[model samples]
Target: MTSPGMSITQLLPDGKLIVLCGRADDASAWQDLLGPARCLAIALDDAPHEARPRTLRGASDHLAWQHHAIGGLDGSGWLAEPADAFDPDHTATLVLPDPLDPPDAGNRRRFGFRRPAWRLFEDKTMVDTLWDAAGVPRAPSIVGDGTADLSVLGAIVDQGTGVVCSCQPRGAGPSAGGDGIWWWREGPPPTTIPTAGPGTWRVRLMPLLEGVPVRLHGLALTTRIIPFPPMELVTLPRPGQGTFLCAGAVPLLDDAADLVTHTERIGVGLRERLGYRGGFSVDGILTPSGFQPTDFNARLTSAMEAAPSDRRVLLHAVNLLAREGNEPDTGAVEQLAEDLFTIGTSCTIFGAATHADDRASRTTSVRWDGDRLVPAPSGAADGRLLITPSPRGWLLTATLATARLPGGGRVGPRAPEIFRVSDEVLGTNFGHLVPPFDTRPSACLPKVALNPEPATR
Candidate 1:
């Protein structure tokens, strides 16, 4: 009768609070969403003075962290077991990371520090089982170790279907920068995708799935070809085009609610089966029949940005936060989201040591131009977007309502097709920074590499 109780609330010892970011948690966006609570920016790694004490970016709001977490800064600081910081109770709502991992019986969930769960939400077998049980439409698939004989792959190819290379028992690539492409097996591959492997030679297979040539598809929460490192990996469709930056949830673009409902069911099934209490993401394909489950990430996926749109998901998450005693108002969260879609409000909150450097508190430019989300320029060596606010100590960022999605959404003409814009181009090339700023002695900037052109050799 009460809609399964997806939302919760909590009270922290100090006035401090922690709110899980189900959607884009960029500083510019959070400034408005959780305005009542004193804001604390959590960074996974070390940052400039203002962005210090870099906590697990969103780990404070995870379910596992509720019991043991702490908060400070007069409602600004939080130290907890992650999930509990947002919702003390496990009523609903889940936290997932990026670059998910495949599910295994040996997998165990950890909290607080950056446990493996702190990464992406990936659960391959779980997804397959759920879809198979639910009768969701999907591509044919074959699952085995990296060195299994493949009859299914060949059968699928014989039918003229291209194979989506799936690396079973997921492994790391050449490095963090490599693409993580996988797929389920099906007869013949799709024509829209370019050829894969050297000379685009598709591999043939012996019978891995009933002597039937099945095309292979894979689940990839994180890929190598990502435009920028870290936080910017989540993809956004270009304007007008309806697609997901991450995997799964593509088939129900017209009906995100239904898609989310099915997704939640799968999540519940997985949690029950695996004792999985962290981040888990499901990757599937959209076929003529319906949505097919491609794989499961026993971990987290970047798709979390979509959670804010789902009422059930948000409510459950809040309940979990409530158990931890740092209940952020559900009404406020909803109002903030509505504002973003309507009037378009933006914000940036900084957290740094009391005394830092000149670079600690200054942002080069912040402007709201014709729906185009842009950041001004800074002369710092890193030429990074994270600039120090004026008067030092505090990192400053401007939030504004724009005509288009900012930080992590679609860009360019069709701006709805999934793609990530080079921030350097937006900040420096397009000169979208906030100004009346400092152009003084520069600090050592991180050396960023350049992306090659698509046609280059």
Candidate 2:
């Protein structure tokens, strides 16, 4: 069992720690948290030109890079040998895999990693069954082949707004972020549908629930489950492109009792059925009636970053301990949740993929002038906008002075405007976008009672 004040190093086995990160910023954060002398931080992507302390760049992908990092592969072809900074035999080495990737057998033997069986929960087409098992309310959905007539399948679940089609993974891999999802209006479907490969692919279709996109995060402990406040998903739509951009996340406008209930139920189901541990998030739409879940991610998500700065690292450590079959101090985990609710300060992080290879970091002071964000003199801005080149593309992040706008509401509505400013000032090439429309009961589309209890204001 682990205590509240235990440092991350103490929880790990006595050895030299090696942290493999998918992004450079993650490596830098871990390095700062654990210090360079204690751990060797290696980034999978090429190190940014301005990265501090000079992190080593390994293979572009996680599995291959990790194999070489831990002496699994010898120097051959493009795959380089393990770094000589630390001797694995002389100093017992423990490698921390990237949270996003599933660990292989070699790493699992050395440290605690999430079980592969649990990763099946990430399949979009398979989650509806889990929701049914958990008794959580969800939108109606149908799973069929990709080549099937979408218009026919959509009509079954379409409630006027339209239907959302999600392509399931063709192989053992999980779907990429927001790439496999498409929203179609009430019209003729597209000729060329997205598929994992040439062979048969599975697709799940459901009515697009119109409303604010929000997610509830939960930590499933050994004894109980703790749910955090809802967060705005800030997903923007590109109509013609038939896809949505997952901008980032921020604190929600208000909290609902139903959301908490849904999260708790989902967490309990995960723990009892799948033996899930650590953090998980449920994505759904906050419609007029109640919370309607659409997706489930059985891993630590971006929402956990909104916790208090000091507790963020510790929260991650607690998750790792729980995954390792060790019980964490339940009181401390509950305290972290309470502190987050008490603080109520928004942790807004928005990003746009530029698809450019330029390696540079730029920060601009900006203020909301009417509806748009414009450049402001240094020290006289309401927020700071930052753009940096990443492995995937250029990343845009905004830190606002306040959680909500002056009028006060969810941050999702302002995502389009922020993307516009980024395109104008930084040339991010986001083109055009729009926020999700509020879902209301209509004659054509009746109200959906997603939860047993009505939503509380």
Q: Pick the candidate with the highest TM-score.
A: 2
| CA lDDT scores, all candidates in order | 0.29, 0.64
* TM-score of predicted structure 2: 0.82
For candidate 1, give the lDDT of residue 203: 29
TM-scores across all candidates? 0.37, 0.82
Cα lDDT for residue 370, candidate 2:
69
Query: C-alpha displacement of 209 in model 2, angstroms?
Result: 0.6
lDDT of 2 by residue, 344-426 (tens): 54445656464432442266677877666778866667777777765445667877765435455556666677777777666
Clashing pairs in 2: none
Model 2 CA deviation exceeding 4 Å by range: 1-8, 28-38, 46-85, 90-94, 103-110, 190-192, 195-199, 305-311, 337-346, 355-361, 377-379, 439-457
lDDT of 1 at 174: 13
Report clashes for each candidate as comma-separated counts: 122, 0
Please state the error at residue 26 of candidate 2 in Å: 3.8
